[model samples]
Target: MPPETARLPLAHALALGALHGPAELVPVSSSAHVELIPRLLGWPSAALPADVRKAFAVALHAGTLAGLLVLVPLPSPGFAVVATAPAAAAGLLLEDPIERRLGGVRATAAGLVAGSALLVAADARGATGRGAAEAGPADALWLGAAQALALWPGLSRLGLTVAAARLRGFDRGAAFALGRQAGLPVVAGATGLKAWRLARRGVDPGLRAPFAAGAGAALAATLAAAPLRRVTSVWPPAAERVALAAVALAGLRRSPR
Candidate 1:
């Protein structure tokens, strides 16, 4: 922070954390919210550097990982290992290129629309019999493959993971648990990589404040989003599409020639 600002903006960090944690826990295109919400509030542009923004996102995710661990019980160690393999592999291969080239507002909007459709369809058509304990490596792989969709950004990792699990006949709780569990390894890996990159770029001392705020907010929100028993319908996420469209339109107007 500049000397003129004096105190660190804990409120902004908390607001971002509150926003990121729930959006992430519910898996509704948190990638969209992390960027869109900040840009919308002007929290991430001039006031915060790009690197700090990335750090804050990573920290918020780390916090969500903690909440998920507590809120959703993990599968067996072997079960989780095998299940996380596909997405971990995918992340190692594709993370950089996607971040470098595919991350843009339009791509995000398209992905959110497509992902929302998948979430609702999976919920509506799924048979909801098996529970999370019944989920095996094969099921993990299925959800892991779905997790790859998050590489595109604006596609909810939670959405695709839950959708795939639900479609695989897992019950709602099981689907949600497995979906979130499956994401842990991948998210952890991605966050670690981001932190490493930030370190190489010479980590800023200011990163700590945002990290603390985001982590705290994410921890609270993740716990809250769980056990809420959301009944999925088509219309709710439609509003998300509208929001994304508006964001895109705004981005177009703001883009420089």
Candidate 2:
């Protein structure tokens, strides 16, 4: 089948979308899950064109962003702009190249392991007391840099941002808050940009229903998982990333390619 014509079954779309919510809310890479899950399941969507997959991923992100907007308080405009600028610039300049070169399972597995290690180190060394409100220009810049680094597949935006915040000495609650707030603008901007491109190109008629189903599922799942925002430790998610990376590596080994 032509990659563009490959269908994403509604069941697959809904499953991925539902998984997207909590995966996005936590430190695990939601993009990794979206990509790897389909592959692992031997779903036809795994063979879709990269552009089509990306568009669907953007749709999921849009839903997640909508939920985040409701759950997370609006950040200060200055903080939002500064904290999001690095990633915005990076995405514009390097997103395609990075995706082309580093979007493979091997690279993603390496990124997962590396990012998990960083999270562990940061959490261990970080001291408690500072709140998200205490973030300054330097904090924004550092957080923005972390977000930029996350453009590499499996280097999760949420994980990196939280690690950056923790390294900056924020408490668990504060780090989580800072991570979520710092990420909101970036996600919104990326989703909007991609959605615009998808709109201009026009979605395939066959994809529209799946797209809508996925987006709705993501939005509902995110809202339902709002309570997970209170999670204090990053260790569990870090461990999960490592385990997932192992699974991906094992799968890669088993593949004839």
Candidate 3:
């Protein structure tokens, strides 16, 4: 197919970009939404080449990272490095295989369900005592492991890290802070790596406009939703994941396999 003809439409790109901000800022899996929303809506973008989809997703993440850099302060340098290392290594080694093997609707949906359960259970049991300033190496390791596990499409980086923080006995505020802090480095690293690869490969001229539009929309949406970072309750997002998962599973069952 001609590159121009194969590119995702501008409107779809903008819509997904807008969705990425809040979805990413919260515990919901932005990647799952990016993958499933177009398919659920029967948008042709869902059928675009995997490379195109992946590139667009990376662009969206780049925008989110930019917004986060403006809105959230970084954690201690040592803690941030420790918390980001495992996921960075995991992304280097396993990203391609995970995308190839588990990027399907079924696996994504399963991840959503599983992640929702973990979030709810962790929140229910977690004590509200420890603060972000008190986070130690053990907490960093736990958060790093959670971030690595989140490489699965539906296991959100924010969600899993928050759950990990909670399980480590951090309060909701601390957990939320830790999740955002831990996630920033990982997102920044991954976005930088993927952006470099995309640049080397050279994006099609025809698709550049859509990519720019999506990234701008994501940045705007993320800035607009900055207040949401203060929200520590995980119930709403957890429920949302379950509902989205159900929609995905139902759609999958009804589609021609």
RMSD of each: 3.3, 1.3, 1.2
Kindly indicate the candidate among 1 and 2 with the higher TM-score. 2
Model 3 spans > 4 angstroms off: 1-5
lDDT of each: 0.71, 0.90, 0.89
RMSD of 1: 3.3
lDDT of 3 by residue, 142-196 (tens): 9999999999989898999999999899999999899999998888988999999
Segments of candidate 1 deviating more than 4 angstroms: 1-8, 44-49, 199-201, 224-226, 229-238, 254-257
Q: Could you tell me how far off, in angstroms, the CA of residue 166 lies in candidate 1 after the best superposition?
A: 2.3
| Poorest 10 consecutive residues by lDDT, candidate 3 | 1-10
Model 3 superposed RMSD (Cα): 1.2
Candidate 2 deviates by what RMSD? 1.3
What shift in Å separates residue 115 of candidate 3 from its native position after superposition?
A: 0.5
Question: In candidate 2, what are the lDDT values of residues 5-76, reduced to their tens digit?
Answer: 548999999999999987878999999988887887788888888888988998899888888899988789
Show pairs that collide, candidate 2. Answer: none
Stretches off by above 4 angstroms in model 2 are: 1-4
